[model samples]
Target: LKAGNMVGPRVYSTGTILYGADGDFKAVINSLDDARSSLRRLKAVGAFSVKSYNQPRREQRQQIIEAARELQMEVVPEGGSNYFNNMTMILDGHTGIEHNPPVWPVYKDVKALWNATRVGYTPTLIVSYGTQFGENYWYDRTEVWKNDHLLSFTPPSVIDSRSRRRTTAEYGDYGHIDIAKSVKYIADGGTKINLGSHGQLQGLGAHWELWMLAQGGMTPMQALRCATMNGAAYLGMDKEIGSLETGKLADMVVLNENPLDDIRNSESIKYVMVNGRMYDTDSMNEIGNREKPRLRFWWQMTRGGDMINLPVNNTETHLFGVQEGD
Candidate 1:
């Protein structure tokens, strides 16, 4: 904010994780009063509430909740599989919970859950598991996502396909996050969902994260709100940058289609009005069109319009006869 050009969402950061010997940053509570004190201490420095990147068990987290009520500070507990022990972190008195959202049941009724706790959710799909989708069937859309880059980061050792009955080093088990189920679940729930594409892998993975959220369970309007309102609320900057209200930041997005009607229509963007300027999507697409033929020529030769059954070249495959001595 001081630089005058670092504009995105206003942020409230919890300085650092104060954890015990087990690296237990998410869980611990002697009492509610202690939780409140912890929140006040966090707020006194710079944060508006107490926040963490993981969740603890039910019994251990109670004290934090109790303390939060006493100090009138928000408590946000992030949830995940590897790190989060509790799924209902928001219900535990945290201002909100972070993403672990693969299930439709969880995303759809999330608003009700938030209202019930008076908190929010941060669906950071990109961070946790989006990139895990290696050469996934859906992402094979050459026009949308090319796989050349995948070959670079995706070594055989990086994959863990143990879930398959046969044990083989040939495949790594990562990718495809039950996205369809999750999308339907969250969209239908009509909750206050924010967009946070865990951003470590895909350069602009947030865009894809937001797109998936809309394609999975949110309308374009709903998904946009997740990127805007939901994120604003999660960051405690709702009054500042979440909406187009007077005195708020002059940021905007102009689209040709009603995303609310068809969330996928987001790809059909025409112009984007941001800060106070416009970006022409048509021009961007026009540039891409000129090079499309070059990119498609190889696929055209291999498949001849039959995309699904494209022949896999086996000339490179190796096979040898068993040794006679054996």
Candidate 2:
């Protein structure tokens, strides 16, 4: 509060710990009791939540979730192979999934899993970057790319195609289903719809997510909540900035159109209020820059420019005297 600013967005840092099968978590913290202690340590350090990855066994995953619960920490699981595993994590107390490819993505039953999220917020940012979405992203026409500059580049994310590694339009286009499921889940009864942009250009992909959410079935307001209020609650800050309550920080955005009627209206932000101060879009455009990549665009060579030329699944896989790839 040194800024003497009467208000500010209440922030909570999510601490993610990468653990391998034979790492320190197993070597040093071998017992279930030790796991609880480790989580407590993370909480003591101001981490609102602790996330560990690279788990290879069901037993191990369950143990971690239990240990976190014993310590009252929200458990977040990253590995998903099918709808079974996805549902298991939700039932076993995982806050939400982090990838969309693991489900092999079929919206036919996504409403079931999404319903689980209604009891809580599940950030589908994984659905946007992983799965076939990224593949479709590469296929994005020049106009589509410009329309989605965030996915074109700047979104720091990954592809969870590791589960099956199938290729085709089916590989990269389940993004639509993810949005559809998210919408149905929220409309059915969700109170919080945590929006996860998967970290790139904060504005770019985040807006895409909202737009997709609306396209998939969410009303404008429902989609807006996914990015704003719901996201705040996922971070454990429901008392501060999720709504326009008194004593809450004046953190909000002023859009040209009412999002309750059109989710895409968010892209029309004219102003932002943070810490009780207004940031006009004109001034907002002048406060930020960009970052360099840590990896040499691995997808470029591994996948080739085939992204734009790839064929859609279930439609036509072959053309005049040539396989789509050939």
- Identify the leading candidate in terms of lDDT: 2
TM-scores of the candidates are 0.57, 0.65
lDDT of each: 0.49, 0.53
Tens-place lDDT per residue, model 1, 1-326, is 54545323334466655232256354344565555655676767866566554434465466666666676656666565432343456556566666654443344245455555545656565543443432232233322222222322222122223111222222223333454345345434554566765543332355566666654545567678777776777676778787889887666666677766766555455544445434343322112223211111122233344332322221111222245893
Where does model 1 exceed 4 Å of error?
A: 1-12, 18-37, 82-87, 101-119, 127-180, 183-187, 201-203, 253-326
Off by over 4 Å in 2: 1-11, 21-30, 79-82, 104-130, 134-175, 182-192, 285-326
RMSD of each: 11.7, 11.4
The alpha-carbon root-mean-square deviation between model 2 and the true structure, to one decimal in Å, is 11.4
What is the C-alpha local distance difference test score of candidate 1? 0.49
Clashes in predicted model 1: 16
